[model samples]
Target: MTATAPHFEAPPVRAPRRSVQALLEARFAALLVAPAMAVIALVAFYPLGHALWLSLWKINLRFANTPWVFVGLGNYVDAITDDARWLNALRVTLTITFTSLLAEFVLGMIFALVMNQSFKGRALVRASVLIPWSLTTVVSARMWQVIYHASYGVFNRILVDIGLIDAYKPWIISPVFTIWAMIGADVWKTTPFVALLLTAGMQLIPGELYEAAAIDGATAWDRFWRITFPLLRPTMLVALLFRMIDVFRMLDLPFVLTGGGPGQATETLSLYTYRVIFTDLKFGGGSALAVLTFLMILGSAFIFIRVLGAPVAGAESER
Candidate 1:
């Protein structure tokens, strides 16, 4: 009698209104994005699909009489195995990519940090720093060419004055200096873009974090390492991802500066592909190279996206 059983009622099944609402909202969002997706497919996917399809064939536009021969994977095999020029171009591409990226990131970070401080002329400094990045690749490349000119280039003159070298040497020629010259120019122009991204990222960080760190007896270096750097990780990853792709597929700079010349010493993958397609009129081989370049870019992007942490919220959740 003291332990009387309490009666419990079974839960009633509802109309699932919340789930229905969520489903409807999702559908609405998808509908809103449909147009953009369609445009991207039309512009991006169509060309990529066409290039992939074209790569499987042997189509030499030079010989109009010969039919488009289907040599599936043959072009890829040649590029991977038999092509010496392709290998050299790939090497040059990677060398510039890594070297320029490192220089840009380090210098960009320094610039960003300097620009972030509360100092006189900060606004003017920031704007001026972006001038290099704002210039078109062609303009920047031509400008650098003038600076690197053999006889009267400013760079050679400066080096001679500084006694860095005995005499003004060829900056855009001589395989040893050609690639490096391009890298130097690229880093100078691109570092500003990286700095801009980082500065924007820094602005998003809450001032309270810095204030709290200061109260807790953290030095500037300690705060940067423990707070600012961690917070800026996403921005840095984004900057690097953009730069890696741009550097890997670079064409205009090398083409404009050195014409990928002096015996193809600085020929990038894009330059070589351009020569193959437009110069030699080998559409199939050119398309194969394009496809390979796209794949490499995709793979690198995938790795960066992975390291950046998918869902993006995952990084926030970890903290």
Candidate 2:
């Protein structure tokens, strides 16, 4: 009741917001990602854009021409209908892609199944499998070239010993056998990769599922179909896609082994483009071929993802 002068109450003070620190953290994150973006734009996008632009021009390496005359879609037309070479190259490309993919898938699946079992020396076997895959493409091609030689080749010696052939023959020089030689080399080199991927997928499958299937008196084949196949689909698709893309762009093996020779039996789109750019000096036509090859890859990827329900690496990573 003393009625002392009411003490003036001080207004509550709010804490200052740390807006500057938040902004600095965001800036740091952006700075970290900027280098990757720059690298992608420079290495991937720049060449793609240049290739597309060059495809529209009528530029020949042999002729002296400046400003590269724009021929609109003439180059594309030449590549598609006007040239029989492109068609032949396309056929070879598809043949290699499908055939090699099929072989790799079957062999890789078998290898993966074997590796998935508990066995002795499994680590050694896995290490051995990677040796061929680790060899350089050029080295593999040269080694296979030697093996396919008409004289003093291990393959011919083995075939002769086994009574498979009457005499040694030049495998790479024959048009009929050139494609098969290329396919064999490719399969040998790449099947290990497929096995590795499939093995990884196999590891993801729960062992309990197999145990449960066994308790139900399911056979090995039944367990594989019902339990393993579904889980392995994603990885199998990934391996198939990678092999298909590589086969489509394949060049070094066929180039070195057969030189796309014996009348173009093994010539693929990549080899065709190389011939156009280097041998024929048709830069515009080569650029058009490059663009078309890129489109084919892109279109195939889109179709596989859309129709086949394949899981892309990016999508899988996001999940």
Candidate 3:
């Protein structure tokens, strides 16, 4: 009788409630990222869009009454056919890109190999290698400009002293040598950066692989080709892509050193764009050049990724 009838109640079901703190946190995170995104859009994309818009117009800055009338690809036609300067600029630009990139890649690889070897003071050496890269591009260009001066430059003195040349030669003043001189300066300045990236990649490789290869009687070349080269491919592609982009838009060094050269010999697309915008005050034409250069760079990067077997974002994520 006593055990017969105890009243039982069901456990209460919890109700879902919105978390104010979590909502606030999400909002705060979005707020934090929004400023950076806005800045990037304004600084990078806005100008690009504006430039594209300007490119379609026929606005000459010299004419006070000139309206920005839509000219529908006229600027591009002018750039391609009517403007011989664009052709010259393209020739010089391509020459500099190919020659300088080749030299930089070779020298950077050599430097990376050297730096990868175990040695005393290696940390100090690595830090020193980065000094040039850490410096401002303009500052580095100015320093090289002094070094490349015809009469009083240390480079010329050294060349003469070493019997490389009979006397001081005007490197930046001559069209024949100006491109080469610019290439040299660019290589020296950028190779260190390339080496640093390669070195980082190399460091990620296991030392045990090399040891095992050595134990198996693999020669240095064999080990490099079999083990090191394949592993380093991704890193090399990354470095090459970055350097190639920079090379396409190179302006400061050539500008400071030669001001597009003695006879437009060092006139890269960047310098040509600058001259069109500022010197000639042809904003519309300059914008067209800018758009063309942008397209060229984007197309080149796409082609490189496809040709070089680089991993696209989706492939990389899966990996």
Candidate 4:
């Protein structure tokens, strides 16, 4: 070998101190969140994943002895293209969701404005308004069922007294009326929730802004349109999203009120899935329906996020 200079390795380049601390902090933050992430994955995602897995098989609990038959996406395809019940339920679900959402938005906005004003008995009004929302859904649904009762219902009694109808017609039994009744009940029960949300948003706004608007000669209508509504958009979107999700998966009211009856006129997607799984004992089909419903809800959340430019009520500033 010819004579050669001693080979030497270059000294290791050290990272900047601040960058090293940042990286370590990021790792520590991730470590802190890992337990909560694990809990969420275990609690929330496990059932969803299990449902997805079950949806791919033909698992008829009635015949548990038979091995699960893998049908890939057949169940989903059947629900989409073949099942008439599923189609009808989807239509009913959309109708209720849209109509109730519209009505609730309007009424809720009005109630929120009124509650935001400085007036006597304001605290009492807020409490009274929240009572409907605070009651359990099952209790509210049962209360509505009694109110729409065919024989002794207050609705029919009032209508008869006013002579709107010649006799006490069964509003809950008639196909057309049954759907409308459910929509009305849902709007009544949930509008307060929307109002509550909007009221909270309204409170966050500085009252001095309103005073300044008044000094600038902005009419009440103009102020509402310009100042109130602009700031309330995030909250409005949140309430809309929450109500949409709840109505999309509605079960108690329909179950207690119509039981998806009147010749399946009011069968919602939730009720349909329940019957498919429990009543029909077709867990696979039900799982597919459930998964489809979850996807729809997830898609709706994205639509809200994109359309409103908000991740939630408070994330608009982040955007």
- TM-scores of all models? 0.87, 0.90, 0.87, 0.87
TM-score of model 2 relative to the true fold? Answer: 0.90
Badly placed stretches (over 4 Å) of model 1 are 1-31, 308-319
Residue pairs in steric clash, candidate 3? none
Segments in model 2 whose C-alpha atoms lie over 4 Å from true places: 1-26
Among these predictions, the greatest lDDT belongs to 1
Q: Please name the candidate that would achieve the greatest TM-score relative to the true structure.
A: 2
Task: Please give, for residues 157-274, the per-residue lDDT of candidate 4 as tens digits.
Answer: 9998988998887888998799999899989989999999999999998889999999999999999998999998878877888889899999998888788989899999999999
For 9-44, candidate 2 gives per-residue lDDT tens digits of 244334354566567889999999999999999999
Clash totals for all models, in order? 0, 0, 0, 0
Whole-model lDDT values for every prediction: 0.90, 0.89, 0.87, 0.90
User: Model 2, poorest ten-residue lDDT window?
Assistant: 8-17
Better of 2 and 4 by TM-score: 2
Superior candidate under lDDT, 2 versus 4:
4
Between candidates 1 and 3, the one scoring higher on lDDT is 1
Cα error of candidate 3 at position 93, Å: 1.4
